[model samples]
Target: MSLDIKRPNSNKTKKKMGFIVKMQLHNNNNRGGSNKRNLFFVFFRSYYRWILWFFLSLYFFTSYFAGDQSSPSSTTTTRLLSNHNPSSSLPSRALIESSAIVTPGIFSGMKIYIYDLPARFNVDWVTKSDRCATHLFAAEVAIHRALLSDSSVRTLDPEEADFFFVPVYVSCNFSTSNGFPSLSHARSLLGSAVDFLSDQYPFWNRTQGSDHVFVASHDFGACFHAMEDMAIEEGIPEFMKKSIILQTFGVNYKHPCQEAEHVVIPPYIPPESVQRAMDRAPANGRRDIWAFFRGKMEVNPKNISGRFYSKGVRTAILKKYGGRRRFYLNRHRFAGYRSEIVRSVFCLCPLGWAPWSPRLVESAVLGCVPVVIADGIKLPFSETVRWPEISLTVAEKDVKNLRKILEHVAVTNLSVIQRNLREPAFKRALLYNVPMKEGDATWHILEALWRKLDRSYRRSRVLSE
Candidate 1:
């Protein structure tokens, strides 16, 4: 059997058939000789479809051309605003949009260009010592690794980048003497990285390193010295003075160490380590120890070169409350110190050489209330984490009244503080993950950088374009 297919323009045949029917009606209904009226009806009925088609085509053509003439910048602005995830929290949107920077939703649109430096600048140190990536001063390695795997914010092209991240591992040089990292070669290593970038790429010279970012996760940040007096004497390097530094050292008062543009970031603590401690902890979450401290607490702190360790704060605590039953303070390092943190009610976070300490993050992450006794110390992620609600701050001069202050809090708002500390957001904000999770330390660092987008020369140029 054979089959026949209809022509592609079958609608034309239907229009012709309707026109013929209208003609037959016009011819048959003219009982009187009113020819003009009959002819007018025939004309309108036959050509109405063509008129409608003409107007519709004209409307669509005009719309297409008008869209082409719209400004590219306005289209880009709409695209940027529409890129925000609907599932993101309202507070995140408010935090991103509150700044009247170059555009809206730039927090989501932020792009960083990480330099592809030689392995000697970064990964070689980690290979040399496993402690390079897990130590207390390992924020440099953590931020670098996290950003390398982050595709949402990292861009391969340098021309489109908002900021340049120079991944130099300055804090990985460990000394054989004290097992602590030596900052002796930090300046030279970072300075050599700057020279290499300037020679190979134009980004460093374009802004004179103003739009670049670095991590100085040490006692005095870019000063790269453990002692404050020595750190002040040799201030931030000249090459890194204009760039941004992510540091663990900060203060409410003016100081020579934190003189450059910087963001206060928590000292690095491995996420797996925190998870292991939480796993080994009691299922009911029982804290037995009253007030715990397990670091240096000298009976008589010697004055060396017009300075004292912890500015004599830890020494005073030992002199005042050494033998108290409630105060379980020690001066030795324990292998399972994190297990101890999980069982403590109050963890002493007194000043060491710097105001900030790794114990502040450890105690906060382990569900222990941090009794921060460092005067004028600035904590990290204050914008996202509620530091005051979860922790207590005591003046360095009030070492004798430490018991009274903690007892008063325990009687009044201790439960309130413990409830706040148990929130997962607080724990996530202080720990750095390898691939990076939402609300983690690296993410908060990106949020802090997002607020400073006004410094992005490319964004300004993009808006003007």
Candidate 2:
């Protein structure tokens, strides 16, 4: 019985034991691997969601800030014409082509009417008897030529013109006459003319209305004062009151109209004429016998001493250099070719009716050193130009010293001195050829007014919409 029991179930028991051990080991490995995989997936999913949200927020904030910074910081660029330098080099054809003294778009397509009455207004009298009138006429002519040459400008009859320019020469005092009694009378006439035209053409009132711009070239303050008085008497319209532009070439009286824009045009010979005069000039130390002061030899009523003082200086110069330099005092002519005399090494510019005279411009153009008797004459364009480098202005009390200075300049190298006078800025004035600083002033003022008017029109249109 013991032998039979020992061998009974060995094979069956061994096989069952092997199968249970293998199954338990396999289940344990599967559970451990599944736990590891689940833990890794949970950690990765959480961090990925956070990273995606962070990137989205960063992109949105950066885009919003960048857009906010770009909207308001904008500007415009404008090109300015280059200044001319006569001393450095000759002007190129392109520069010369681009060089226009007055730009065309300044008038905004408005036609300018210039009234010239040669019969009632004597051209000979202006050239010979009235120096002031002569200067005014010259300035007007220069402006006229500039405008006519410009393709953008159109000269129309006063009746058909968009802008009317009238130059009235008055001789009588304000106390005299009835219809043209005073400067005020002239202004009233002007105002009446505008009103009349407006009544005839309704568009004139609708377009320009009381804002009509007027430019008047008067002989002196009598006209200017008269206009102001008339404006007061007639009660200036709100629009036309401030639109008057007055220019007095040689007025002794101060202006009463505080609001009016006043301009003074000094006498100036054109650069081309000055050049011709220089070319005709004699070589160093040679003088023409007929060279004399043209125009009026008499002193200006306002400058009595200037007349006598200038004559005395001339006498002294004649006495000293008469024999050697051929001192010729023609009554009012400088050898018929005034530019030649101006082209000479020295030019004597005594005090005249105005502080700054055309002589300064003439001297600069001719490359001559002007010996100015600095007393009452105020220089034109002092704001933008340097006088010391351009001319020799000496005190009226220092004529003797001035003479010595001129003598020194004569002996010094003239070419270098002329070069100094021919700076770029100064040359532009010459090349563009302004008769007086007042011309430039008027141009700039008108230009500003036009721009303001244009802006207002644009704003009104925008608002209407």
Candidate 3:
């Protein structure tokens, strides 16, 4: 096909139309219009710029329409190409859009709706005492505070929630006598909260509190008692039997206190305190004290209601290794005990009133090899932390051979255990951080809850729907 554009400046415009009107211009040599044909050819040669401009315009026009037809495919190709080429000068629009989108984390759409209970249920006690948030039994407060600030797994919409969190600060009612948290009001407070939830929302009633989660960071968990016999007799609260509990109390053996579905969590120790200990720690990592223990190592462990404190384990340790060389055991409390742990090789983690103790977390976080004497005690975050690789476990009966065991481990794998203790992950896994850092105590609780999504009424309903 041919195109002819007229020129407005000269008489050549009239001659330009003559080429279109005349058909046999190629064979017009015998005709009298040969001059016209020659004139047309001359005019065409002089203004060749118009032909070039027309072809250029047509190429761009076709390209514009073709590009519109295949834009989606072109964008995908650009993104794929850009990903493989790290030195790409310009980022694709697809990459920019994807980067702006908030992707789901490991919880996989797991959403927990925390109850907006009254201040009496949680923060009222913290307002009264700063120790409420930092004490060993403060995991209840720690987990609640961490979950409140967490945006990843925490949701405000109750209708779409997978599980409900009841944030009751049960461990904050400090007794006036010994300054330890009193469990006298724990059961009643928790029971009242359950009653309040059942009255206010459909969630508690829908699953009979099965999909709800509570933190029972006490000696005997939901049983709300420090003594084993009483804790056993009382068992878990009748209302909280189906609910999940995140407690510091857990035993490997079958126990009434842990009868409820629960996740064993480490007792709360301030992350700042752990950081302070790390800051003041020795540069050479030299441990001066060999086989250190600083706590109530009793000469005669008192028998309270037929059960001896620590089951007579601490007393046995005191009787046998109290005056021995290199055995630094203290019967009195010291404010700077964490300093002693930082300078210790083997920190004793003998059973207190309960099997689990804050020393398990304290020793591990401070890079001390914990000589755990609590048999059948379940440590927190066991799935994430290899406890056996980092700490030693001694039976209550084997307290006599404790020195021999430590000596043998020192000769063999003490360095190996210390190296494992120095890992930041093990420390991070045991502490609760606000806003819920990954692999932290609060995060591990969410992981444990994720495993129990089978009991989530919302999840089951959504799957069926």
Candidate 4:
């Protein structure tokens, strides 16, 4: 096991090299090298997040908040306006950037290309609804003007449309029924519109009409007779059931607002009436009138659902308090109803044939706390507005106990509730004022429809996979 070992030439050369290296290190440490290294680590541990956050925030803020508003038709600005605080003049770039992730520009620059529906669908449809100052005709006017005037929403080209607006005035056509077959005209018009859409664009056929918007704002029993499969009044065909339906009478048991496609929009207010409500101040802002009701009290005994008068809510209220000192009751529509609404501390809004009533909007507009008696009714925009804050809902069966319910609301509490109703935000909710008015009824409904379509798209993608 012999091994040959070579002895070190390291004795002279290795020792000299090590000594030189050690002297260099000692000289560097003496000149504060260790202090500089520790100081560098200290700074890194203390302020790195603030530095990183500042740059990341800057990138996103410049991208979203500074969106191209100069494009008069830009939806990007509206989307940005919705997600930020209304009073926020300028938020810190980081705070806004954090929110930008969740509030995405899904519809930025997206166009709502309204179909140039035949004159029958629009102007002619106006004649059918304009005979009276009611919700159906009012809706014809409101929905039509909102889309036509809002430059930010409409696009002249169908090819660029993100969502198609089908101006199907089903309620307006149905308004002409006089114990005769008036539903035929509306049904024929709607059927023709659907046929035209199917023939003209692959959009309806490809999506099965899921991307369309139909404003069928009528009492369920009054319109959409197609749900019954009636040949004459069946305006909304079964194939188009997937489209977004906007109406006021979306009862929970029937319409079930929890569903994806049904949107509960505000019933129309006459332009003059809205202007009048907006022009005058309430008298003393006091509950001088204990309660007020002015409408038909006749019950449709055969109509047991009591959507309008079948439930005996009106009859019960009239029977119990018809001549009460403080409660004012009118058996028919009165001329001073608007003034009465402003005077009343609580306005009685009983069901007629549906859970929703136009009086809900009227009362809110005039700064009266709405005493909603619609059973199983889902209030419109309830996702954004808390109903109980500015209104009260008594069970349809509790119509007789209306006074007791009002009694429970303390005078102090009633004042607070009235104050809530008086808010410009609450008033804004009850009316589809006009175009370019942010956060009004029409704006909320369209925004809701956009969200519905977005969710539907996501769901379909997941299913396809």
Candidate 5:
């Protein structure tokens, strides 16, 4: 707060010293401030860099780990082919080949023989007509095709072919009052036929101990009955009874035959094609009530339509409701009829004299709600599938209520119903060929029998040794 002055020389020295001391103090203070500013900047820079690095590392690491976890494994790619191989307990190619071989002819390796029957069999309803000849010809054709495919098959005279494949008419003596064959009679006839063939041909002598597989296009019960009766009549050992594989289309437990493996082949129509066909058909309002019965009624004089109901009941229903709804007789090739059924709210499936018909498959394929009339007739392949889960089963007495039920369905949501019926079993039945799919079931049972037979054959060989 006070200033002092001095002599010139002493004052000059004092002033210089004082100036030097003041400069040194200011320089010290400036150095301290600079050090503090530099330290603050270094701390700030390191904190920001650490945060950026942490976030970058986290983002990259998370993305890499996520990609690894989301990828699928190789095991999922080959799952479909896994169940089809013989090594996995399925039929081997050798077994199928041996079974398919026509005796007395060349011993060809495994091959599938497709038998195409003449259209006449479909047309002929009565027995002893040219239809029987057609049936025999169809069988012969199948055998011929099999032999032609393989040069190894020894071609004998028509009477002496190594194997004879026959398509027994659905109307044979073995069948019931309905056109379907009787299981017991069918089995007996088949057994006798096999024996007759064995006695007639020398080639079958070696096959006696071995198992043979046969696929019949007739109903399942007929096939089973034939096989069972054959085993008993031939005095086939108890062990060998299970060795025969018979593939059939229908299944009924009440029949005397055992339940062999079988497959249900349903009719199928492509969805888009069906929709387009329906668009061209006449409106439901425009269809005449008596159009279906005009001409065909004479051909089917008993007035027995294949399904729906008996002639008497159908007549009553027509009389009562014919004015309200049109009833058109369905031709197999009618695209419009198929489309109308496909687009309909409900499809009526009254059992014919027979419980199982092609119509059931057709209805399911169309995605139409099948209204099943549960009658005394036993359903084919009912053991393998649940009818109610996919279809609406109505009692025979309740047949009159079909219209009301359909009306109710129209008010309900249809997409949900379609979704419910589209199961894997239904799809497989619709897509695959009937005889081939039946052959697959036959293959399964035959494979098991073959394994047993092979073991027996091996044991006999060892005993002989």
Candidate 6:
């Protein structure tokens, strides 16, 4: 039994023991590797829902932000040209390239017939509007001047015309004696025109002058109708209100061009401003001042609540932030206003007796960003013009916070806004387009009137029914 116990070799036994040790070590190593992988899997599984939630939240937020900007927002440079007439394209790229101010197509083969209004109705108001420095509303004469230009859509024969241009200077009838505009005189002018048109043509009787249009930048101009006294509704003459009315103010709740029959038009741009903007470079020049405003600051305190209360805004502006650092203010029109504007970065176009003004144009020409203070004043050619892209709008309430708000604007952003003002689309759409330029303010007006006429006609029909 003792001899048998010693029979196994020590080397063999040692070799077998070493082999068993190596196998156990290898298995332990494999198990160790597998456990690490298992630990990773466990960690991933525990946070699986959190990871999914994080990604889903990101996706939802991204979609919401994208939806917010599906079309250009109010403050963006992109224009919203809604195809009101689904069948036809707008006066867009191709039309712009061709420089067709009033194209024959979207005009839908329709002709604009200018009413041979007595020179008195249109001419008498010219000097009156420019009587004061800050008080001006010359759309009557401006529109008349636009009509004088060459156009393919204008028909020499009124019989073939689909729209009538009534060149009436309803705003000019003011009494210099009391320094006040007589709504009575304005009414008389309107009344005389209505009588003449009704007696002369069967057209006004047909659609109640739904096809006629007039441009009046004055707030009191459009409201001077005897319709309130008449046995009719609408508080204005049926024929005049039924026809298209173009005014400087856009969509007002009452007076100064109301509703679909009203198309917002730009205040006439001065020839000097247009010329300067044309000759000047678009980006990066010497801009000296932070903000520039030089006009009448004396606003009547009694009439402070009115929407077109030009006085109240000026009062607020002058009272709160006048004669401050980097903020220029003058009681009288600065003789060097253009020079100052040229050297400045921002020009304050506050309400001056009315909402719209030629100052807005002057600011753009001098390469200054306009700070529009007039509430509800729609910049010219707004249908195709992106106003906020070119200017800063401070509401009447924010006049007190003017400096702080303007200071927040980065210099980098101001450059882009100033540069955007120089775009051809904006120039053509916002300014009185030079002879034969497509996207002219007048052409846009015709296009707007053309689209609006059909809908307006239908509405009038329904109202009458």
Best by TM-score: 1
Per TM-score, what order, best first?
1, 3, 4, 6, 2, 5
Which candidate has the highest lDDT of all?
1
lDDT at residue 449 of model 3 (Cα atoms): 85
RMSD of 4: 11.1
User: How high is the lDDT of residue 221 in model 2?
Assistant: 29
Consecutive 10-residue window with the lowest summed lDDT within model 3: 77-86
Q: Is candidate 3 or candidate 4 better by TM-score?
A: 3
Single out the weakest 10-residue window by summed lDDT for candidate 2. Answer: 71-80
Candidate 6 per-residue lDDT over residues 134-192, each given as its tens digit: 23455466566666675776777777766777777765566769664455566567678
lDDT tens digits, residues 350-411, model 3? 99888988888999999999999998999886654578778999999999999999999999
Write down the worst ten-residue block by lDDT for model 4.
226-235
Report lDDT per candidate: 0.85, 0.45, 0.83, 0.66, 0.40, 0.63
Residues 1-465, model 1: lDDT tens digits? 999997799788788877876776677666555655666676778799998999999999997886565354334333222323334544335334533322323445899999999999998999999999999999999999999989889999999899999999988888999999999999999989999999999889988999999999999899999998899999999999999999999998899998999999999988888889988897788888899999988787867887888988999898888888998988898978899999999999999988999999999999999999999998996655568878999999998899999999999888888987787766877999989776678977997899888889899888899
Model 1 misplaced regions, further than 4 Å: 1-106
Candidate RMSDs in order: 14.1, 18.5, 15.7, 11.1, 19.1, 14.9
What candidate 6 gets wrong by more than 4 Å, as runs, is 1-105, 123-135, 177-183, 224-235, 252-260, 276-284, 299-311, 433-436, 453-465
For candidate 3, the TM-score is 0.77
lDDT of candidate 4 over 429-464, digit per residue (tens): 667655636556777776676666563433456579
Candidate 2's error at 463, in angstroms? 9.2
- In candidate 4, stretches whose alpha carbon ends up further than 4 angstroms from where it belongs are 1-107, 127-129, 132-137, 174-185, 221-236, 254-260, 277-283, 299-308, 455-465
Q: Report model 1's TM-score to 2 decimal places.
A: 0.78
Task: Quote model 6's TM-score.
Answer: 0.66
Q: Per-candidate TM vs. native?
A: 0.78, 0.47, 0.77, 0.71, 0.42, 0.66
